[model samples]
Target: MVTRDSAWPGGVPCWVDLGVDDLDRARAFYGELLGWEAPPGSPETGGYSICLKNGRAVAGIGPKQGPPDVPPAWTTYLSVADADETARKISAAGGKLLVEPGDVMDAGRLAIAADPGGAVFGIWQSRAHTGIGLANEPGALCWNENMSRDYEANLAFYRSVFGYDYDDMSANGFRYSVFKVDGNPAGGIGELGADFPADIPPHWMAYFAVADTDAAVAKVTELGGGVLRTPWDTPYGRMAILGDSQGAVFAVIAMPAGG
Candidate 1:
């Protein structure tokens, strides 16, 4: 398990948050499923709730801030040394900024951007909030991955902006790679082939570690969430995709022994 008291290194995926219409329902659904304790959002921060696990910050749940048609979804935030500089790089690398770099009440400076492949993510330059406090443990964020329809363009975009090196793991008909920072695996990028539904746009997916994948799947269904994929074992672990009652998608995984 990984724990941190300070900001994550630049280029690492440091946090994941969900923006939904029903803050209370989202809080309850995740609190029950992942053993999180989320206090009511305060007006000062525009009703943003920071979900905690074992008394440490794990993720955030907040009211949706975009257009009315945009669906509720989880967003992955990558740590950076300078949010403004990263925003510049994003534009230079064929990305579009949805939100310009700005401070969020001194918690951090942030910018929301979409890669050429249309995968949206956040760039964070932390201040008081240093991102997730715990990870790779049950109920904590274990992984984040970007699935891209235009793989090559997105790959170039990230490499240029974040200096990420990839450890390709493609085999058979699959095209996948792990993005690394200083030789350590940070996240993943996978090519969304023709088999993927055309309507599903490129997006980053966040994975939460669980003690038992099947149990987590059952709990999700019992909590009024729907399973998008059944639990399946891989060399890494058993995992499944799920959608919350608000239609926010995320994944849960039971990591292999000593993994």
Candidate 2:
């Protein structure tokens, strides 16, 4: 199990949260599926629900504040030493700034941005809230990946903005790269497969750690959520893609011991 007691390093994926249409339903579904207990959110923080596992912060669920047409999705947030400086670098690297750097009360400062390939993500400068308290453990985040049509362009944007180093893992016609921070896996980038519909834009997908992939997928189905892919084994672990009851997509994996 990987546990954290302090802020993450710059450019590391330190947090993730779902922006859902119905906060109550999201809380219920995730609470049942991931064994999380969400305490009452303080109004001072806009009623954002923080999901906790074993008394530690795991993730968040909040009401979607985007346009009415926007669908619920998970946003991956990377840690930064300076939110304002990272926002500037995002613009200079050909990305569009969605929300300017702003403080979330005294919790931290954040900004939303999209890569040139249209993958939206967030940058966080931690203050009182230092992001996820437990990760790489059951019911917590394990991996985050971005799928884009123009993989090279998006790769260049991230490298330019964060000075990220990647380990190319492309093989057998599949283009994939794992970005690392200080020798630890930060996230992944891959070219959207040919099977992906053209209308689907580039996006980031978060993966939660589970003790049993097949069992988790079963629970997802039993809860009225559909499984996008049956559990399958990969070199890294066993994984399955799935969508929540509201169609918010995510993945779950059971990593090999110590992997």
Candidate 3:
């Protein structure tokens, strides 16, 4: 059983979803690269496909159902007590709501919101579907981040919504904002306002933990995926930027063993 942490809102993040350009191609690449599989769904849930690892739900793969210009990327969702209440808190904290609380068949009720700094994530209320059944595996999502524009606004916004505390860590020559719920690490945030052009959009990026970054990069390429950035050593671990066969970009990190 996964260790229960009282600091986290819902015993750590269960899963994440990606808005991909082409769901079919994304499925193919991930299946080939990670040995993961997914089955198509019913209209009751927008025909979503739950990505699985070792025959258990790990994440999700879906089409770019939002605006046309929105880039295809992976998004992480946090389990919340009530998505409606969380939406209210988000707005009161200076964040904007993209989608109001709505039920997707029996999958669950969910709402999308952006942080005060413009990073987006989902608040989910589970019913029949609790969450991803597996995580932190080689083929499953492992880490999450918000590349935001305003650091102070982001901090204030999340504190009001989730009651989180954070500490700044100077790692790899860049100041990294590490997220903690109550006291345990939840994720990290990075400042990308000036680093990225105005035309570039701000969004949350999910990271998949791989057994070996080098092997994953090579395998991704072999499966028709792209490597936006080559493998490099970060203070936390070795990582590389990878894209699925459908041009949906994400990341893979290999942490040092025995941490």
Candidate 4:
């Protein structure tokens, strides 16, 4: 399992959080569904509950800020050495800053941006909080992927901003590439196939690891969540796409034993 006590390398997907209308309900739902514990955070921390798995921080759940129109969804955050500098590079790379770089108390600085393909993601400059404490294991994040209609444009934007190297891994009929940071896989970029539904927007999707994808999906439905896609086997793992009761979609994968 991948565990860390220090800040992640810049350009790596370091964290993910869910912005929801009801924090209590979200905490309870995820706790039951994923075996997470999300006690109320201290007032000084803006009551941002850190989702814990076996007593280790895995993700976050917090109140949704901004206008009421802001949708409840899971946001993937990339690590950066300097949020302000990254913000400038993002705009220069043809991306728009949805939320300009700003300090999150003293924990870190962060900014949200949209790529040329219109997929929204965040950049985090860690200070007090170094993001996920455990990963690549059941009940924690394992992968993040950008599903885009314009893969080339999105890839170019990220490469320009994060200086990422990619390895083309397209096979069969799927077009996919693995984004690497210092020779280690950090994330993925996938082209939305023509068979993809028109209603689905381009976005960053977070995947959590599980021991049993089929069982996890069943528990999701049992807890009032919906199944976006049924369990299917991939070359990498058995996986399923699911949505919380609030309609925020995410994926869960049961990686082949050693993965």
What lDDT tens digits, residue by residue, belong to model 4 across residues 1-259?
Answer: 9889899999999999999898888898889878899998888766789999978889999888679998889999999999999999999999999999999988899999999998999999999999999999999999999998988998899999999999999887888899999999999998887889998999999999999999999999988999999999988999999999887899999998777
Residues 129-165 of candidate 2 have per-residue lDDT tens digits of 8999998898999999989998999889999988889
Candidate 1: tens digits of C-alpha lDDT, residues 1-259: 8899999988999999999999999999999999999998789877899999999999999989889989999999999999999999999999999999999987999999999989999999999999999999999999999998888888888999999999999988888999999999999999989777887779999999999999999999999999988999999999999999899999999998785
The candidate that achieves the highest lDDT relative to the unseen native structure? 1
**TM-score against truth, every candidate:** 0.98, 0.97, 0.89, 0.97
Tens digits of per-residue lDDT for model 3, 1-259: 1332221265245458877767777777788777778777666655578887877777788877688987777777887877788889888888889999999777678888888777778888787677777656677777887776677677677767877778887455454688887588878777764546676456677888788999999998888889988999987789998777776778998877642
Candidate 4: 10-residue stretch with minimal lDDT: 39-48
| Pick by lDDT: 2 or 4, better one | 4
Query: Which pairs clash in the backbone of model 4?
Result: none
Which pairs clash inside model 1? none
- The lDDT-based order of candidates, best leading, equals 1, 4, 2, 3
Q: Estimate the Cα RMSD of every predicted model relative to the unseen true structure.
A: 0.8, 1.1, 2.8, 1.1
Better of 1 and 4 by TM-score: 1
User: How many steric overlaps does candidate 3 have?
Assistant: 0
Model 4 stretches with alpha carbons more than 4 Å out: 44-46
